[model samples]
Target: MNAAVLTALIALVSSVVGGAIVAAVNHHYSVKEDLHARRLDLSVDRLSEAYMFMLLNLTIDKDKHREYQIHLANIQLFGSPTTVSLTNNLMRRQAGEPVDVTTGALLSDILNSIRNDLGLDRIDTADLVRLNLGDEVDLLKRESSK
Candidate 1:
């Protein structure tokens, strides 16, 4: 074979191999990203489930709101138990240590925002345990309806 034709053949093979390697890497990275997203989704689901359970408890007994609130406080503290910072006013009094009112308010806002994102209207203690959070809750119910 001519030298040029031989050189071209080698280059073609190299290109094909390089493309395959790149595609495999891209696919691996994409799967990793999807796994991360799934983990985050699971975390959100767990948090929502806990909230709903608390709501159910509150609905069953009027005076159980405080107990449910305590459960929520524990959930918040699970990651940063010694942070000495409160996220919501309702959680402040349950803190094991002193808390900053402003930080607590900010946290309250963040929690409320999450609830709003999940289609919750209000966070009243009376309705906390037994209220429908709208479409998001409906979707969850349908998913588990089986």
Candidate 2:
């Protein structure tokens, strides 16, 4: 091939190769970013499920206990170290083991740990709210009075 034509062909080839490489790299990173986002979403879902379960139930029946156990396993799997520790402490308290903090406080700590894991700002435990209905509210008040 003539020198000028050969030079033009080389330039075209280099550009095509460079573009393909860049596209490949971008696709790889995009896939990785999507995977990371999905995993984070799953973790958030699991944490929310566990927290909501805690909020809605005042007492654990057989089915509720089973559900709680599932949540516990998920927390252990997907939660941060602090969250796992807090959850373990809550479990210990539930099993009649002596723990330094109240159940409510432990729960708040767990929530804060989860928030931290999800890159959210932490809130005071006092700002934490639980929803309770008639008898449940009365029971909680009576317990607090004791």
Candidate 3:
């Protein structure tokens, strides 16, 4: 082939190869990022659900305080908040978000106190406190489900 035709063929081949590489990289990274985002979303959803359940339980009979405490403990073990692990900016973004760490901890404390004052043995004050104020929320429900 003439020089111009050979040069054109090389350019076309290079363009196709470059496009494929770019697409592959983007697809691979995007899928990984998407998985991470979905995981975070799921975590947030579960945390919110736990908070709602606790709120609903509180609206029940005060005589069921022990049961409610157990439920709170279960939420603690299950919906443990992990938002604290997020950066300050992300946490700030959650400023308007309900079921925050402070609030969750307070709820746990009140439940533990009511349970203890009622002479309940199935519950632990420190565990309740830790579960409430502890580190990032864990996938406690998944662990318990097994």
Candidate 4:
């Protein structure tokens, strides 16, 4: 090939290679980000479901407290350390291990974890504090009544 043709060919080859590299790198990053987001969504979903079961467990008439534990255990597979700690408090409370915590506190921790995982701003304290205090109180009373 002539010099000009050869130079043009080299330039085209380099451009194609560079473009491919960039695209591959971009795809790698996008996939990584997508996986991270999906994991977080799963964790939040699990936590939300667990919170529901926790509420059901609170009702003295129900016997689904043990089922509530399924969500908590699943969180361990996908949640961060803070999430695990918060769930542990609930476990302790259910076991009547004299934990110095309340339903509101556990709720707060779960809400905070969900918020953090979703990359949301700080939650309003007033909203988090509105949890009915009856669950923990009732659990205590039930223990004594038993």
Candidate 5:
């Protein structure tokens, strides 16, 4: 019957359209997810570089002082607001301009920003100490076994 053939044709066309819609939606989501993942990776790398520079600065290595500035600049470009704020707080303290923020609080803020970037729950300073201690204990056990 022509009616049956017409019905089948309509069904086929509808299915094709639906499939195309689904494929387009899927591709869009996949690209979006990949972009998001890349951004997070970039953020992590920038923040880590900044932290390394901060550590290097602690040694008072004049040669690395310029490197420290470059690293911090990279962080400023890609890092979240919290990361920038922590760097600003430390820079102020380093300049010896009498920061209202305590050294302890500044350090804690840096750690918290790092944790947040890593998608971790915010932890108190005591928890950070405990985390370090746990790793130390693992090292101790390994040493004792050796």
Candidate 6:
């Protein structure tokens, strides 16, 4: 082969190899980022469902209990470490365990942890108070009486 032609071929091969390496690296990172995003989305959905179930006091209802348990399991699977810990504590408190914090306080902490995990602003514990309308209160009283 002519010296000049050989040099040109070598340069072309080097360029092709370098380009492939860059493309592969970019693809690997893209896949990682996509997986991370999907996991975060799932975490958000599970947390929201579980939080709603807690807020509605539906976890106590026998019919809804299984669904709530599923949500809790999903939360454990997808939540950050702090979120998981707080959720476990909340469950323990619900089970009549001697957790030091009041139910409302523990709920607030769990909400704050979830917010932190989802990159939202933390809410004040006092701001997390539950409000029930007269009918809702009456319904709860009636249900508890049963």
- Best candidate per lDDT, number? 2
Tell me the RMSD of model 4 versus the true structure. Answer: 5.1
Tens-place lDDT digits, model 5, residues 1-146: 69999999999999999999999999999999999999878877776766655533444478777887787677677666765676676678779867554434444555566778788998865333222333554322232234
Query: Any runs in candidate 3 off by more than 4 Å, and if so which?
Result: 58-146
Q: Identify the candidate with maximal TM-score.
A: 2
- Model 1 agreement with the true structure over 16-82: per-residue lDDT tens digits: 9999999999999999999977765654554455454543442336566666655555446431332
Mind giving the per-residue lDDT tens digits that candidate 6 earns over 69-93? 8977876777667657766876887
Superposition TM-score, candidate 1 onto the true structure: 0.46
Deviating ranges (above 4 Å) for candidate 2? 113-120, 135-146
Off by over 4 Å in 1: 58-146
Give the per-residue lDDT of model 4 (tens digit) for 1-146.
Answer: 79999999999999999999999999999999999888777878888786666644554334654565566687666566766776677578768887655655555567677777778865753333223455434442333333
Worst 10 residues of 5 by lDDT: 137-146
Show the colliding residue pairs in model 4: none
Q: lDDT per model, in order?
A: 0.50, 0.74, 0.49, 0.66, 0.65, 0.69
What value does the lDDT take at residue 77 in candidate 2?
76
Against the true structure, candidate 2 reaches a TM-score of: 0.80
Q: Tell me which residue pairs clash in candidate 5.
A: none
Ranking by lDDT: 2, 6, 4, 5, 1, 3
Q: Candidate 2 — worst ten consecutive residues by lDDT sum? A: 136-145
Residue 29, model 6: Cα distance from true site in angstroms: 0.1
Report the Cα lDDT for candidate 1: 0.50
Residue 105 alpha-carbon offset, candidate 3, angstroms: 1.3
Candidate 4 off by > 4 Å: 59-62, 124-146
- Cα RMSD to the true fold for all candidates: 10.6, 3.1, 16.5, 5.1, 8.1, 5.1
Q: TM-scores, in order shown?
A: 0.46, 0.80, 0.43, 0.72, 0.70, 0.77
